[model samples]
Target: MPNTTQNAPTNVEEIATSMQDTVLGIWADFVNHSPFLVMGALILLFTWGISALAARLMDASLRHSKMRGSLRELFVRLLSIGIWITGILLAAMVTFPGLTPARALSAMGIVSIAVGFAFKDIFENFFAGILLLWRFPFEKGDFIECEGISGQVEHISVRQTLIRQTSGELVIAPNSFLFLNPTKVLTNLPRRRITIITGIAYGENVTEAVRVIEHAVDECRTVHKDRPLEIFPQAFGASSIDIEVTWWADPTPVDVRRSRGEVVTAIKGALDEAGIEIPFPYRTLTFKHPLETVSLEKSEGEIS
Candidate 1:
């Protein structure tokens, strides 16, 4: 038999000996790379120091510019990231002499593809947050409404937005949702136009009712006296005329609530004092044939 032992699987002793040789080879390689490793570490430390100093300098320069606060921060962060990335690539090449720029780029491209697939939503939110801070009108402390979520923006970050609801609950919303949907900025302007319906008895004077309602709203402390006030007889109701009352008020939630309350109170008091009736909601009933009068009365009672 010619070398039948060599053809067979290696014995335990032989396996152990081979493993020991491989370990020794790795150890030797590592020992040879010690100096390079130290140099790479030093380079990384220097890079960090440079990045910090550069950020401070950049921030100082940006303060004099009219840039938005969020946008200014973004520029500084991007500059730091670029510097750090360059430093890391240089360190990586110094540590491993065989890692050339082309090779490093290829490797990075492959790794980036894998990472992109693994963190699709994360990247989406990151880009969305960037767009929001860079170009969009959203800012910290602004009250915004998006997809039925109405709240004051507390903080905005790379992946999420912090919104404090009117009921004192904090909502951590993903930036992608806000970016992809329509967002209503309630406080974009100092004043907001709000509307309410006021009804008066059909027999009441329409012109006089309009004048009374206008005066009542104008007297409200929360109403913007300089802004136009509109009171129009909108429609005819069963027992009253529905008038649409629109006025401008402060755009804050607290102010909005208080202003509406004040206007409503003022209108009710003025109408009552002037002997103008705010009629109860009334409905008309008809039937193909005459029904029991008691049933009709009962149905009307339930409707009321």
Candidate 2:
């Protein structure tokens, strides 16, 4: 009765007109506050410039400090982040004068929780790396073993550690793994003990062999003299007697190998000169009963 189709068009027109008016009002308000907006933008730009300058100065200061490389980098990065965060907070305040610093910090805390959950592993490794750098467990160039990987520490970054393995492989290991697991710092001590098992004939004198091995280890230039050399009879093998020879040498892998080689050569030469046989595997055969001579003859007659 009231021209329903015409009314629908009118209603749609009314809605569109209302939206347009609202948008125009908002634009008018923005124009009125243009001065404040301009000032806020200038403050943000100034803040960014100041932050950059401060970060550069801090970086230069840290570089000249006597701190370790990893520690220095960590401090520099943290300082830069702190400066930027402060600048951003100041810029935010200038943009929204009604937003209090306390309220903003509370909002940041809430946001940080969400971010933490999202990047759980990243934060874990970051914190672990910080701990490692602080504790000074092992420095660069030190050989270490962790989680079945053995290598020399090439570099320790914030997220990962670079290790150069003995086999010439480069390993990028997560910092969390090294922090959470048991890590053996091979180069922490001045020297490490190396053990070698050598054998001699059953007829050789055990005391004399021990003496010879000890002398050989002592003669090695790479072997450390501070620690006592140990040579003990370990076990009796099928062909020869086994002796465990342990000696302390330089902690480095190269020195360990060189010292072991020299010790072996010296021991072999001394033993051979003394006429002591380094025995090989030997077995003797015996019969329970003597064979009858008629057996072969009877077999041959049967075949014929």
Candidate 3:
């Protein structure tokens, strides 16, 4: 076949020689540009040092300011990241004069979209934490309620909020839950109004009962004297008339409990001294016929 088999060995040898030449050329180029690689490494090291120093300075400044802990950390982290990224970009440019950071960033953006979808919950919490830190909805030591969680905020972090529940349980709540839902800042106001419903016998004077309750609440030291105390006849209960007593007090759980206790005790004593009865839930039952009579009639009918 015209020495085809003999020519095949020559073709194979040529292919091997070509690959070897390509590898050697690449190695030669790398050796020739070794200085640039060394410079890039030095630049990267300098960048890292500068970034760290800047972060420390930022932390010190933030500590002296009135900024919140979480917010200060956030700013410091962002500053460090920006410094490092700029440094790396400069180093890359030094290493490869023709390298395009913009083009690389565009490629990274496309990859980021896929990563975002895969870690949706993680990113959601991260951004939510950032938002929470930015907006002072509630701060550490503030009592708040969200999604059935009632507690004082212990600490706010980048991913979650640490809540110390009134029951003494520590809850690590995700930031997304607090941000997405409606949060009640219980201690936002200087004073909060507390209401207690007390019922008295229907025979008691409504006007007199109101006076007694109001006077009792006014006597409580914890009750805010500047604020108005209110008492109204809410409704007639099954066995007593319900009176709604409300008074303003310091917006704290401990104070609320103490004030309420004192007010209740005062009201009870005042009502008792006035001979007003706080009636118990009483129901009267009336039967058309006694069980014994019904049973006797049934027995007589069966005999008949």
TM-score per candidate: 0.86, 0.78, 0.75
Tell me the tens digit of each residue's lDDT in model 1 across 90-206: 899999999999998888889989999999999999898889889857788899999999999998887899999999999999999999999999999999998999899988998
Q: Model 3 — TM-score against the truth?
A: 0.75
**Arranged by lDDT, best first:** 1, 3, 2
Runs of candidate 3 with Cα error greater than 4 angstroms are 1-56, 59-74, 91-98, 289-304
Lowest-scoring 10 consecutive residues by lDDT in candidate 3?
Answer: 103-112
Better of 1 and 3 by TM-score: 1
What are the Cα lDDT values of the candidates?
0.91, 0.86, 0.89
Off by over 4 Å in 2: 19-66, 282-304
Q: What would the per-residue lDDT of candidate 3 be over residues 143-163, giving only the tens digit for each residue? A: 999989999999887689999
Sequence-dependent TM-score of model 1: 0.86
Error of 2 at 267 (Å): 2.4
Give the candidate order by descending TM-score: 1, 2, 3
Best by TM-score: 1
The all-Cα superposition gives candidate 3 an RMSD in Å to the true structure of 5.3
User: Over the full model, what C-alpha lDDT does candidate 3 score relative to the true structure?
Assistant: 0.89
- Candidate 2: tens digits of C-alpha lDDT, residues 1-304: 6899889999999999999999999999899877777877787787678767876787788777788766776776677678777867776776677989998898889998999999999989988988888788999999999988998999987788999999999999999999999999999988899999899999999888888778877887877888988889999898899999899988878888898898899889888887888898889778899866668888999999
Among the numbered candidates, top lDDT falls to 1
